[model samples]
Target: MSNVYIDQFPAEAKVIRAAFYSSFLALALGGVFGIIQTLHRTDFLRFMDSVDYYTVLTAHGVFLVISFTIFFLVGIFTWAVTTSLDRGLEDIRFTWGWYSLMAIGITMTGVAILAGFTDAIDMSASVLFTFYAPLQAHPLFYLGLVLFVVGTWVAGVDWFRSWWAWKAENPDERIPLPTFMVLTTMLMWYIATLGVAAAILLFLLPWSLGLIETVNPLLTRTLFWFFGHPVVYFWLMPAYMMWYVMLPKFSGGKLFSDPLARVVFVLFLILSVPTGIHHQYLDPGIAEGFKFIAMTNTMFLLLPSLLTAFTVVASMEHGARQRGGEGYFGWLKALPWRDPVFTGMALAGLMFAAAGFSGMINAGMNINYLVHNTFWVVGHFHLTVGTAVALTFMAVTYWFLPQVTGKALWSRSVALGQVVVWFVGMTFMSNAMHRAGLLGVPRRTAEPQYEGFEFQAAVGSIGELDAQIALGGVLLTISLGMFFANVVGTALNGRSDDLPANEYAGALSGPDDAPLVLDNLKLWTAIAVVLVIFAYTFPLLSIIDRGGLFGPEVIPFPLTVESATTLGFALETAASTSFESAGEIATSALTAVMR
Candidate 1:
């Protein structure tokens, strides 16, 4: 048996594997919670109770959204950055320390949720995972949040340290394309999270502990969204990197433009950070002008997303066309549909980006009125984050499973079937959710009721979608279980082998055909930052009204502004429908907060 030690490939790969397992295991747990929670709420199952539902919700949010996505991204970035640098991981101790801290943090948070202490601090905020103001959970939740963030930060530092040391050892060098992209992302993450982290640790934590008289809820919300929005990209960047750098090779072609990928990363880093105020479109405390600016800026972040979409598609198309595929759709047919890495990334990317197109509406000042906090938001994110982002993780896992454990997957067909079912189920389910939102079905409520027949009909239709989604979820969950079993079994029982050499490798710099503009991130990053500054400046400044951050008793801002004043503003707050009684859509906002 070939002995592929932990450091055989870069320690980064091991870290990536560790991260993958961590996220995957956590996600499996989250999925179990989600399935149970969804079923209990819908009456699809009668076994669970309110306490179980809430606990599952807490676990799902904390683990799936908070833990899985971030941890997976960290590991992938580590692999990409170190591999690009052609070096082993720079600091083994730091890597292990970061991993251990994250594991401890996640475990602590999970245990805390199970112990029923979440509502101790502020019972009202226990309003399902988003933890919006007026409702409060125990201080343990906030502490858990802090610990998770710290764990992530430690990992982020390790990433930076490795890349920096590599650069220092080779002074006169341009950063490798993949490593450069990751570094810029982490830099943006550091800058972006600072506000929310401060708001949480200094304000929310203390307030929850009864250590402070009150926290500025409005300010906290604003800061939270600011970090919240860009965090999606933080989860997504490695997937993008893998798509640009590795997918093409797996499909038998070179990356079309190394530098263009760099530009996209840098652009996302800067523009994605400050445009979070778009989430506050429905809130009153923020000024109209500030909201307008943030809305405008949100549109700008789409450019980089579009650019990446185009670049990755082009690369994939080129690979397809090269493989004896001819005309338009022919290239699609020629794609390596059987290869886990290539097909999985391509399908996931397309669907996620397609779903993300709705972001334009969500970001728009007028359109958001139609569907904010409704199933539309739910549908959009499931496609983008749930489908697209999660699929990437799956693809990477499948691609590298053998290398990490030195065994073939238990069943390739099972893996492929899982991907297909997920795509199909997500499409139908999200579409129904969007339709339900049009029917004014609010999110976060256990059930929805309406007076009109049309509304009832819509609700009836939603049942079908929900059923389909439940089925899809079941299939996906089963697939995940099989995957975990395969990996574990392989690790334990499979013969050992040397980890494969880096297969889809790219050079630090592109060939002579590379465009000059693609090589530099500074310009794109600057443009993105400027765009964000323009977006968030006014909104943030608007928070300091005289009375305090809340409203009326605190400030001169009108409690009721004319709809005309809202001009491009989307949703009408005055006529907002509430679910005071059971069986109607819940009014609380679900934080699309997780990246």
Candidate 2:
């Protein structure tokens, strides 16, 4: 029998099991809301009232993007830390502490969102994941996220502590590849969390509590995006880790270049935070020059992803060749399609490649003007974090579960069918959404009201597109059910099976070939912080200059409950409320700051 996680360390297996359970629970809930929201968006299905649509959309975004994605990352990182270090956690009790904190945090936030369904509870957090003010959520939502983020930070420290202890004994050896990946990704996350934390504690949470009634809309928004953009990479990094480390094994090949892998991660740390301003290109408060700088940085950020595409493909090719395949592109046929783990990950990568092109357009200063806030943007991300990160997680679960549980998959065919259905569903849905977007169909609405003017599609009618999206959504939901059945059956398995070692492929050019500087995570982290400061300082100062602290006065409006006209902060400082009379407050603050 190949060495399994269960056979080697049974106690640790329980931790991984809890993590998986947490993950799939989120996947199940997220999958349900996702399909409902999709159907509602296309207008083919309309059970959710127009008023409640934003609530469901909030659930879809938070459950999938925040809860589902992060739970899986922590689980995968746990497995990575334990398996790579070849040592158990510092204490399983400590491990569960962070897990419980995260679970509690998610529940608190989830309650706030679900509470929005009824007026009986005045508490509601329908302010979607962005939480852009002068639209605010309940204080519980911010507190929940704080608990969640802090939990992750502690989890990182746990992993780092594990490595530090291991290194002391194995002083001569380099950090294991998995451990290295975990550490760097967590480091990036630690940096990323600072943005959101400050946004919450200093501003959003306080404002929601009525502790501070007003906040600079642009300042809070800038801070949110500061964390916002890097969190995308945070979501993608685990999938990328699987691609770099696990996909090659799935293909029966080894990693192509370990050194290049280090370089890719280092690039992400330095570039991800600085480029967040690109998300605000359409916003009014930020200057054109700052936007231009962000655009340039955003463009440079693509280079790492492009390099990743090249390296991942090369590694898969090497695996194909090792399996006795020959040909320029024909070697693709040699890949392990029979294994759901291999097929799901491969298809996820294919979708990500397309998502990448769309992202570049979104990053473009000029092109973004044509398609901002349309279903095209929705379609673009569904292919990325939605399909790419999410699909990869579902796929890896097939392989990782058995390793942790010491059992064979319940049914390989079911797992295979699950991934295929997901890819087919996303393809139909994403394509139609993209097409409709080009026809000027706006995104994120319940009814998508369109009686004023008929949207003429170049290739198909609106009815046809809606039908495709609805059909695709149904298929996707079925795929999620199939995934659940497979997981449940495997978890209840009565017998164990012999399996290959739970190990990733090594690189052709190993860590020995990589420069020593790549190991200096501290140096990289410091540089990353400096880059963030340099990029954000100017735009933030400009916003502050325009609006005083607590902002040049404004009123809060609930975006989900109010009409479109209500989105803006209605009154200028002259009519605005503050700690004192508006003029007194503005003049005093300006004088205090300048002095």
Candidate 3:
């Protein structure tokens, strides 16, 4: 009798399966766009006009990061909450509702972005992922984002509701580790998203609809970063959850310490939102003092990451040792390297360590100025969200698919090769991106090469860098193909009665060993809120004070002929009115002199 998740909670499994498929669809679209942009930027191939690059870039980012990552994590969180609580959701209908909302919302947003490629739609949102002001998108874009965020908010509420019901049933028990992670992450996300929500709902949406004439660019940017930086953790925490809970089991051991994992998540909740300004060190409107404070907070964030590394590595080592492996380093060989689930996550973690070192350079205000908007920043995130979050998700899918479908994985060999191929491809691509950035290569452009000015590389020529990027992009595309093949092949396979029971790693040092204070959700949520207030209140006030709620005369970019003509007429009218007022003042002065 296999006690798998689908057997225990058949209703919930259906929703999770739906979420996973939705995410896979987005991944397919995003991956296609990713290759398109990569090949185009490298000048290896150019199917579309250079002007349409931003549209492709926008689609790639929003689909993968927003739709793909978030949809998948929400599913994982659902599984985690239900599995760890040992109970089903309060209502399956509610679960389906949030998923549907997310699907519809992302579809609308995706349509708005893709419409940019066609002249027939009369609508476009080529504003890129940041959707930064001055580069305004169509109103549907902002509206869709609103719906998407609201769906996530509802999803968080559903998780809380489950926890609340479970707490009522078991009054004296501490929160489960997976549930703790989910709650803390949701709390951080709730806080972090407020910035973007405010930006879109209050300002960007109104402006896009022509209800507001202008918006403070600095203010919108400040608001975006507030959400932007913390959103990194929002993506990462799930991957971290998988590492802490699943990795050790796959490694053939129990978790090292339950308390340590709880503390790391708590720290992430409290510190993540306040550190977003580290991204804005080069922006002018923000004072040096505030940027410095953000930099300080960002540095503090490293502590949690370091703790995670220590605890996870320790857990893996313990697992390796328990498998009858003797010696210090030799035990590493005892790990299940043949398992795609294990190797993919292991490689993802190794790449994330490298990301952390590069991230340090990005977090430091002084050093960040050198690569603020350069290709280096791109490479840094490609490692974090791109590999760390993405690779972990793909790797885990090999394990997760079978559990949900009641079927054996179609091909472990292909799964193994897929993960390795992704790792190698990213290495080549991200390495070249970092090197090129150091040589003053700009990012987010159709063409990197200028007519008169050539970027002089310190080591390799620019052509070689381009070649590496193109080769890497090709390899990554191939990896995506293999991944999809496995997914499709698995879905086609017949159900198997023989499957491993669904379970996370047990902890050697259980929750009983940890202090009760670690599970105080209210206390931590309060502290996280307070930290955000302290970090943002003054800087936000200063920005609004300097640049009015709506900024001084600024025009939107990628303007249509109609909008351009209107802007020209408005400018001419203003100039004429000013000149007439000046003449009247001069005439009054002359009359006074004659008298």
Clashes of 1: 14
CA-lDDT, candidates in order = 0.69, 0.87, 0.93
Give every collision pair in model 3.
none
Deviation from native of the Cα of residue 484 in model 3, angstroms: 0.5
Give per-residue CA lDDT, model 3, range 161-272, as digits (tens): 9999999999999899999999999999999999999999889999999999999999999999999999999999999999999999999998999999999999999999
Give the candidates in order of lDDT, highest first: 3, 2, 1
Estimated TM-score for each candidate:
0.85, 0.93, 0.94
Question: Which of 1 and 3 is the better model by TM-score?
Answer: 3
Q: Is candidate 2 or candidate 3 better by lDDT?
A: 3
Task: For residues 338-453, write the lDDT of model 2, one tens digit per residue.
Answer: 98999999999999999998898899999998788888888898899978998999999999999888888899999999999999999998888888788888987887766777
What's the residue-level lDDT of 270 in candidate 3?
A: 95
